[model samples]
Target: MSVISAIFVVLITILMPPAGVFAISGCSVDFFVNICLTLLGYLPGHIHAFYLEYVYYDRKEQNRLGRFAARPAPGVYSDRIQSGGQGYGTIVEDPLVQSEEGRAGATGQ
Candidate 1:
């Protein structure tokens, strides 16, 4: 999602928390939870929706951009990777894929 879309979602959240969460997360567990929260109280729904969004709006885009330049930590490892072109990005790995590859290499050896 883009910044403009994010802003729109935020505005929607302010007016109707559940609707905004539905827009962001779709009809998932979060949506059901938001519905319950909204039923219990308005504030809780708002809190949950905002927490869910948090500009985490574009994971795949950031991951795609992460392939390019980034300044790693000077020593050991930095939890974060900073890029001049964008803000920051972190690579998400699939453990299943890693394990499969590892097993294949070991069996071949």
Candidate 2:
């Protein structure tokens, strides 16, 4: 459950950065829903609906989405969140508290 939702969230985060924060915030919901679907794989949950809702909100509120999305420039939070460059991690470290800017500047650009 957690594992599957984590996978989905990670995928979404990679494709669309905003989803990462949303997924981190809504980890519990995703985990539970994924668990339910896993237990009932034959009649699994409507993931399309979920994706639609997520996408709609993400696009509709681009400003807020920007705030939620990963920064094009690297930051302390990104460094902590990234797991060996693979983007694996269930826990979302506090974005506000991160202070180091890493060896590379911004996106290494």
Best by lDDT: 1
Tens-digit lDDT string for candidate 1 (41-101)? 9999888777666523433255566544344423211122122124336554677999999
Candidate number of the best TM-score: 1
Per-candidate clashes, comma-separated: 0, 1
Give the root-mean-square deviation of each candidate in angstroms.
10.6, 13.8
Q: Model 2 — TM-score against the truth?
A: 0.26
TM-score of each: 0.56, 0.26
lDDT for 51 (candidate 2): 45
Q: Give the runs in model 2 whose Cα sits over 4 Å from its true position.
A: 1-23, 42-53, 56-61, 64-109
Displacement of the residue 82 alpha carbon in candidate 2, Å: 24
